[model samples]
Target: MARRRPVRAPEPLRATSMWRVDQVFLTRRGVRVEVTCSMVNDQGGLRNLSVTAPTDDPVQAVRHAARFIAGRGNVSSARQARVRWAREQTTTLQDELIRDRQLEDEFLDEFEETLSAVRDQQR
Candidate 1:
């Protein structure tokens, strides 16, 4: 077996410096909306970005904002994963709300039947 010399890797190009902004806005309804990040593009031009959430919770608002920005900004594996996770959470919450409403309806129907039976026995 022959010994092979290690090859050195080339240095990466210097990354361009850019100013970024992340802002949170509150609506009259107490909803917190946020912009994950805003920055100039490779062309030295600013890119327009809009991200908002109708949720009152600050944490949830930021996550939703990141989901929106991820779609318009760079397409990276990490960003895609975050977006997918946010969507899954949203779906799960919606399913839970539907189930709760159904349970409430069932309870109300049972209560009405019990009240009717008691009234008939008392008559």
Candidate 2:
């Protein structure tokens, strides 16, 4: 009798939530490109990046996504730049929020003072 080979178990899976896709755009050449975006918190930390490429052609899409996810090539560089730009935008918005709050406080103080002056004049 011939000896039978033993079956091997699959490798463990990694965390899938680390990837957050911001958008996906296809080129004229029919190549699908996905943008894995990272969110920057108030503390300036990058929430992990995500690159997901799915299409009607499962084989091709997997190949493309794997290459991009590996951080190998221009696509990877572009994704990194995009993440940096997004982080800067978040920082700018945070600054604007602080400035607007300050302005609102000043306006409320002035309005209260004007009301008090009018009441005193009527007395």
- The candidate scoring highest on lDDT is 1
By summed lDDT, which 10 consecutive residues of candidate 2 come out lowest?
74-83
How close is each model in CA RMSD to the real structure?
Answer: 21.7, 23.2
TM-score of each: 0.33, 0.21
Candidate 1 lDDT, 1-123, residue by residue in tens: 999999999856656533232222222233444333334444455544555567766455545554454343242212111111222334566643332233223323433454455556659
Candidate 1 residue pairs that clash: none
Off by over 4 Å in 2: 1-99
lDDT of 2: 0.36
The CA lDDT of each predicted structure is 0.39, 0.36
TM-score winner among the candidates?
Answer: 1
lDDT of 2 by residue, 40-61 (tens): 4333335544454555443343
Clashes of each: 0, 1
